[model samples]
Target: MDPRVREHAEIIVDHSVDVGPDDEVLLRGHPVAEDLMIAIAELCGERGANLSVRSSSSRVDRAYRKAIDAEDISQSAVSLAGAEATDVAIAVRADANTFETSDIDPEKTSAMARVNKEIQEEIMGKRWVGTQYPAPANAQDAEMSTDAYESFVWGAINKNWAAVREHQAQMVEILDPAEEVRIRSGEETDITMSVAGNPTQNDFAERNLPGGEVFTAPVPDSVEGEVHFDKPLMAQGREVQGVRLRFENGEVVDHSAEKNETVLTAVLNTDPGASRLGELGIGMNRDIDQFTYNMLFDEKMGDTVHMALGRAYEDTVGEANERNDSSMHMDMIVDMSEDSTIEVDGEVVQRDGAFVFEDHFE
Candidate 1:
């Protein structure tokens, strides 16, 4: 076993969730993450914490996807009760099959997400953290060798998290009071939204191991103009490419996708709030520079920007601040490494993927 795996577990249990004696924790993840789970369990046990582990297999998910219909896809009442009873929740992702559900029905997939809305709400309301392991399937998706991927993953995970947190504080300071934010990338991406009274949340590898982004929910009815997403995003068993959304009065009035247009359309039609912007995120994690086709890391990649459609975080300036609400939260990335600028309150904060004021981040 790699010593770093244990170290990673210790960091999560001790720092991420802050599991203490007599604390009740719900742990769930792929069976492939057993080693990391063991280390985490041992740490929790030594701290006298009670943990319930749900070791799941990717094949099980595949079976569920194939066997279930939209109406059949509801949250387990038992699981909901369990989550509500737990003090902390830690989930690990180490999938053996990244595209295990590629053949599943898109509507059914959306239904599954809709059904689990309450469960996600309860979990996110708790002290929770979700991280991923370096699985072979993940490496293949990132188009890198397993060894290279492992190095990339671990290097991003283990960092000067304190520095990262401090670095992100500057962004929060600027965004916390800003009313309007504008993003421009070349001529294809130019969108404006009002943050107003929303609270800005700065993450530094806490809930996510490779986390380094400052995000906030935008006022649902204040969006204007259009934007294009250039990154490859996988959604509901389908891959979407070249997504473009045009907004008016804060609702998506027009949208297109070069690939998987049907899936994207179905998602936008999921509910009333699905066509609105929920969260506006600015990526600042310089350590993670590669596209892994995984939103967990890609959404935090430096020199990139991501926005989520559907539900906004209830605690952080989303529904908490009267932002958009829905059962879904789909994040899509857009490149901002060059020919782009993010202006907060008409002040240029970042230009061409580099912060105009980089001192605070360093």
Candidate 2:
């Protein structure tokens, strides 16, 4: 194992998760992330934490994708129940390839999705963290050296975390100020929303090195107009691009794409909540100026913003507008580098990805 991997392991073990003594820790990832996994286990043991590691792989998943029955796919990962019951659980994404071009049984995938949803509810909002472990595939598709990709991911996480914190504070100040912020993009983007009385919650700030974008749960049924996802999305191991969505009452009334429309439709139709906007986030990490085809990282890149069509996070501004139900959360990015703006309560706060507030972005 590389020494840096060990250093990263320490960060994951100590910083990302404050694993206390006797805490039941569930460490999970695919085989490609094993080095870090082993290091996490070692750290857990040293900390006197009870640790259980679950190593999943793309090859094994391919076997199921090739031969498994749709109805039984959910049952194969039954062991997940134990992990779900643990005190702290971490999912490290280390897939061999981000895009797996195979005839995947949609039904099987759906069943897996359902099971995962059940698991999320089982925890009923427990303390957990999700992160990534860079592999050759993610690096290859990113068109950058692995070292560069690692830095990109790191900077994205670090900067986004900071932005979220800063935005949360700014939101508090803006919420009480007397203003109905009016904002407009340069052209072709007329998106608007009212953040007059929204509560900005602190994202998982005490837990991880999470950074990139700060977000708020928009008022359900309050958004109007259309927006185009300027960047392609990496969905379920495949690249889905050119997504266009039309919203009415903050719900996705109509959507289409030049690519992967079928998959997008299937995901949207997965549940009723899938049709609604869950989160509206702006990427503000200048360090992450390029798209890497990973929503976990890309949505936090500066000059971009994303709208999640389903499942609002617990810590977002808005009322019971919690669109949380679907096992799915999709992040489609819109490049705001040109001809785009975001307003908070009628005041133009961000024009073409730059903050309007003083000392907000420096």
Candidate 3:
């Protein structure tokens, strides 16, 4: 076993979920993450914590999606029961084949997603963290050598996460009190929305490891104008790039993508809430400088911001903020490294990939 696998497991157990004595820890991951899961189990044993693990495979997922009818695909009672009974839930995403389900019909896959949304939300309510374990397929998808990709994953994970959180909180401080936010990047991207009354979350490895983003829910029905997302977006096990969206009254009235336009169309048609904005997040993790085409890392890259379409997280939008609800929470990334400025009620907060008040980050 690679030493980093043990180190990664230790971080997840000690810091991320903080598994302690007599705790019921539910560890879920793909087969590629078995080593890390074993490491976590060993650590849990040492701490006198009980650990339950579920190892999955892409082949199994592919077979199940193909075998089951869309309507028949429903949430697992056993999974929900496990979530309810567990004190800590750590999910490892180790994709043996990143695009394994790219060929499946979007509607079929979306149906499964919808069915599992509530169970997922229940798991999210627990002390949980989602991290990735590097696999050969992920390296190939990222177009890097396995060793290089492993280095990248570890580098992003083994950071001073606490320091990153402290730095991100400063940006949250600025955003929490703001009434409105305007994002502009030349003529290609220009969008405005209200953040008033929504709580801001400073993410630093709480929900996601390698995390460094400050986010909040946009006021439902408050978005206006057009925006273009240049970064490649991963959703429904496929990649969509060069997205341009025009919003009116918070609804995605018109949208286009240079690649996978049909998939994009199907994504919007997933449900009513799929057409509205759910989250607005600013990436602040300077260490994650490159895009791996993985959302967990890409959305936290410096000089970038992402907007998600679908259900709002209760940490930002309260449970009562139920107007926006859907199985889809697709995040589309927008680069802010050049000719872009984020204004909070007419005052500049970030300009050209850097925060306006630079000292706060330093």
Q: What is the C-alpha lDDT of each candidate?
A: 0.87, 0.68, 0.87
* Model 1 agreement with the true structure over 175-236: per-residue lDDT tens digits: 98899999999889999999988989998877887788999899999999999999989887
TM-score attained by model 3? 0.90
Q: Poorest 10 consecutive residues of model 2 by lDDT?
A: 175-184
lDDT of 3 by residue, 209-325 (tens): 978899999987999989999899876566898999999999999999999998899989999999999999999988778888888899999999999998888778754444478
Worst 10 residues of 1 by lDDT: 314-323
Q: What ranking emerges by TM-score with the best candidate at the front?
A: 3, 1, 2
Report lDDT (Cα) of residue 229, candidate 3. 96
- Who is ahead in lDDT, 2 or 3? 3
**lDDT for residue 333 in candidate 2, whole number 0-100:** 81
25-107 in candidate 2: lDDT tens per residue? 88878898888788788899999999888887777777767786665555434665684668888778878876562567666
**Residue 347, candidate 1: C-alpha displacement in angstroms:** 1.1
Q: Candidates ranked by lDDT, best first?
A: 1, 3, 2
Tell me how candidate 3 scores on lDDT.
0.87
